[model samples]
Target chain A: GQQVMQIPQYQHVQEGEDFTTYCNSSTTLSNIQWYKQRPGGHPVFLIQLVKSGEVKKQKRLTFQFGEAKKNSSLHITATQTTDVGTYFCKGGSEKLVFGKGTKLTVNP
Target chain B: GAGVSQSPSNKVTEKGKDVELRCDPISGHTALYWYRQSLGQGLEFLIYFQGNSAPDKSGLPSDRFSAERTGGSVSTLTIQRTQQEDSAVYLCASSRWTGEKAFFGQGTRLTVV
Candidate 1:
């Protein structure tokens, strides 16, 4: 069985501040997928990192996969009120285990 | 369907009653997964069905929980003798295959009172 652990279970930041969440896995993953769940909404796929040490960015958000392929991170620059939600990382080859997720709150 | 579809957007049941939630996955998708999320909590894996292979039921919390996929299209999750702890939003997702991006349904919010 594989386990994915996310750090900083909850975070509250002022508007325009940056936030980052880390995801670590007990075993190496073939690929990792990031998802975002807004309040009262279902999880939506954000991006997927397949190559080791890959980095991808979307707007003010940046995603990076560790060179070892056992960890990943998501960083948001200059967060806005609309950025309030939970970010989850799914990692694994067979089951695609999901981390508990990091809940973010942006204060206006 | 364009995306995964779950039935009964919300449900309320007595503590001792049985309830079933349905999921219709995207057409031609081979992988379907069930996850439960308590209010303000994280997603908890429940079950997974891939193609015609045997389902992975290792995530089921207890004997009261069970799920089945029919003809590799639709799935039903049944909770027998539901308890207060069984209350949560049950989410269903589908992907073209394993290790692919998953598309999740809105989920069925279950309330046990």
Candidate 2:
């Protein structure tokens, strides 16, 4: 069985600050996907990275996969109140398994 | 556009009761999956249905849990003799295939009291 763990279980930042969360795994991952879930809401897909050392960006968010395919990160630049949510990193095999997630809270 | 819809957004049931949750996936999508999220279990895969054939039930937690897909459309997950440990949010997602990305439904929150 494979398990993914995320660093910084919780983080709070000023509205204009930058925030990043890291995801690591003990086993090699075939692919990784990022998701954001609002309070009391379901997980929404953000991005997916399959190749080693792959990097993708969406506006203010940047996702990267480690060269070994065992780690990943999500960085949000100039965060806003709307970016407050739990971010998850999931390792995909035949099925997808999620990490505990990093809860981001932005303050004004 | 219509995404995915799940029924009875919230469910509260007593121990030993059987409950069923339904999910309606996006039209023309061939892949549907079920997962459970809880503090103790993170996000665990339950089952996945591909096309009209039988589903992959390998991820189910126990024998008490079962699911069915009809007409290659809607799906229903049934939990028999539910226990308190079964309380969690059940999420449903559908994709074009096994390797593609997926779209999720709001999920059904189940609380076994």
Candidate 3:
């Protein structure tokens, strides 16, 4: 079994500001996936990183996989109110194990 | 694309009763998963299903909890002799195979009185 810990547990950012949440795993990860769960909504897949040192971008969001493949980060640039949600990272066994999640609040 | 869909979005049952929650995974998905989320909590892994292979039931909390997948498509999670501690949101997800990305359902909110 693998475990992931994400930070910061909660974050507040002004509109147009940037935010970053880091995801770390106790054991080496085969792959990592990021998800966002909006208030009153289900968790939606954001991105997946498989190779070590891989980096992917989705518009304003930049995701990076560490060289050791044991850590990942999701950085949102020029955040908007719509970015308000809890961000989670899953890194574990063939199946995914999710972290506690980082709740992001944007003040517009 | 049809995402994972769950039935009985909300359920209220008396303690000691049994309840079944259903999940319909996307067509062609070979991997399905069950998770729980308490109020303001993160997702708690419950079980995993992959093709014809044996399911991973290590996350099951107790003998009162059980789940089964039929024809590699739909899944049902049954909780017998439910207690107040069993109240939580049960979420289902499905993926292609191996370590592929997962798509989640809205989840069933269960409340035991």
Candidate 4:
């Protein structure tokens, strides 16, 4: 069995501040997918990192995969109130495993 | 359907009762998964179905929980003799393939009292 560990279970930041959440796995992963779940909403796909040491960016959000493919990170630059939600990382090849997730709250 | 759809968005049941949750995945998706999420908690893997293969039930907490996918499109998760601890949101997700990004349904919030 594989486990995905996520850090900073919860975070609260002032609007315009930056935030980062990290994900680590007990085993190497073929790919990692990121998801965002807004309050009262279901989880939505955010991005997917396949190549080792890959970095992808979407607007103010940046995602990076470790060179070993056992770790990943999501960073939000100048976060806004709309950024309040839980971010989860699913890692694996055949059977993807989801991390507990990091819940973020942005204060306006 | 435009997206994954779950029935009976919210359900309240008495303890010891049996409950069933339904999930209608997007057409053409080959992978379906069921997960449980307690309040302020992470997603707990429950079961997975891939095509016509036997489902992976390792994540099931007990014999009380079981799920089945029929015709490779719709799924049903049943809990027998439910307990108060079963209260949580049951989420269903589907992906086009084994390793692709998943699309999740709104989820069925179950409360066993």
Which candidate, 1 or 3, would have the higher lDDT against the true structure? 1
lDDT of 4 at B42: 85
What CAPRI-style quality would you assign to candidate 3?
medium
Task: Give a tens-digit lDDT track for model 1, residues B53-89.
Answer: 9999999999999999999999999999999999999
Weakest 10 consecutive residues of candidate 3 chain A by summed lDDT? A89-98
Native A-B interface contacts kept, per candidate: 0.72, 0.57, 0.75, 0.75
Give the C-alpha interface root-mean-square deviation per candidate: 0.9, 2.0, 1.3, 1.0
Candidate 2 residue B100 Cα shift, in angstroms, is: 1.6
lDDT of 4 at B5: 98
Model 1 chain B: ten consecutive residues of lowest lDDT: B93-102
Provide the lowest-lDDT 10-residue window in model 3 chain B. B97-106
- For residues B1-113, write the lDDT of model 4, one tens digit per residue: 89999988999999999999999999999999999999888889899999999999999999999999999999999999999999999999999988899999999999999
**TM-score of each candidate?**
0.98, 0.88, 0.96, 0.97
DockQ of each: 0.81, 0.55, 0.74, 0.81
Off by over 4 Å in 1: none
Off by over 4 Å in 2: B39-41, B52-54
Candidate order, TM-score descending: 1, 4, 3, 2
Output the better candidate (1/3) by DockQ.
1
Candidate 4: stretches off by over 4 Å: none
